[model samples]
Target: MRSRLAARLAALGACLLLTASCTSVSGTGGRPRPTGPGSLWNPSAGQPSPSGANAPFDADAALRRIKRLGFTADDEPGVLRKLPGPLRAIHSHCTGSVDGHCVIVLFFHGNDYVGYDAHGTGNSSVVSQDGTTVTLSYPHFKPGDPMCCASGGTREYRARWTDGKVTFSPPLPGNPNYEEPSP
Candidate 1:
């Protein structure tokens, strides 16, 4: 009987150890499960943020700033009135590091903020961020290129975030297949 009871206790302790090892509690006191790259911990890996306290990228606010920088419909000949709509349609993707540094790309149809144009036509991607510097590589379509044809050339844009502001570097010459910098 003594040996049987010891064996049962040992089994129970082993089971408990296994269970504890298999699961961990996150800082929020929730069970820690494996989440993909773009999950809550990695906000920049998914869609752009609408607004948050000290969020790295706020799409609405960024659009407002871009407008203030004279990047408006008036700047483009073919662009009409700025369309009033959710900015998600224009947002391509966002990626970032754990330290509040992130990069977000907004693809403008026909290089215009007026409407939702098909991707890869005269589209231009604006990579913005509010974190550590990141570099992006995207195709630069030429004037009047067909939506299905290849890009005229490739361009690399770097954005550096510092002290609540981001500064974009001038376009750098690069190949179309250049790899993007990891956040």
Candidate 2:
């Protein structure tokens, strides 16, 4: 019985030592290492966290601003049911220097909201930018068509800063084949 008790104690001491070694090796100084999806350490795990302090513009805030402009989601329950969520819009932001000033072009899914003339048949993209303007291009689609599948044609709208606010110009004709270059 004495020998068995001694062996058990020895086994417990070994386990404690092993655990201590593992804890020491896994120490990230003091900060915990990011382990889940979208972690900076896991590059390929998910969408990389937006770089720079101004990246990945806020879509919710933009939506709120659009709402303030009198746009609202249509009350078609049947259509709303087919959507992924209450907010089906997705957005992207591209930041670059234009005329020596930081310019950010926010591209959002225009089709997610109803009663808007800028509703897109497909996803919008930041096609180009100049010294004083940024252009967003998207396809126009017929009524009741999903923005994913079909488009009537392409349209481009230019956004500019006016009085410290972003304003969009009426859309002009665009080329459907023009792809947005990465920032």
Candidate 3:
């Protein structure tokens, strides 16, 4: 097995040369080692480290939990992302949707899904997420406003995790179609 060992050594050398780190190969126990800034292995890096919230958000596990909770995109495209704190956001286009989209934010401490942010209007848009805050923008439609352009402009809501729960500043706009409670 000398050739196999030689091949692994060559691969390891290449990996170190490319990433400038050998943590991925040396002693990771098959877990993905954090290679650099913004790596998914350390998705929660640089954020406020609350007690059990520092664990890296696992997008795959979140996706599985989302499907188990009866939310699925089916064949449509969707978004799943890590937010600040132990939070993950899912923007799915097909959850009993007639207009076809909704944003759901979930919180976790390690592997356990703990809570979620209040639902938003179906037409919600994520404006930005930074530090420990996530801002969502929603279009406000006036009577004469066309769907292409809302005459009532847009409203923004900022959400932060505090005291073991999500607190929305100005509160989350109502969701007329929302059903089911957070798991």
- Clashing residue pairs in all predictions, respectively, total 1, 0, 0
Alpha-carbon lDDT, every model? 0.35, 0.36, 0.49
lDDT of 3 by residue, 147-177 (tens): 4666666777676666655566775544422
Instruction: For residues 44-160, write the lDDT of model 1, one tens digit per residue.
Output: 323333443233323454455333322232123222123222222233311112321111233222122222111122234534322344455456445566544535576666644
What TM-score does each of the candidates earn?
0.27, 0.29, 0.51
Per-residue lDDT of model 2, residues 98-139, tens digit only: 221111122222222211112111245556544255566665
Ten contiguous residues minimizing lDDT sum, candidate 3: 25-34
The residue pairs in collision within model 1 are 44-94
Ordered by lDDT, highest first, the candidates read 3, 2, 1
Ranking by TM-score: 3, 2, 1
CA lDDT, candidate 1, residue 116: 19
Clashing pairs in 3: none
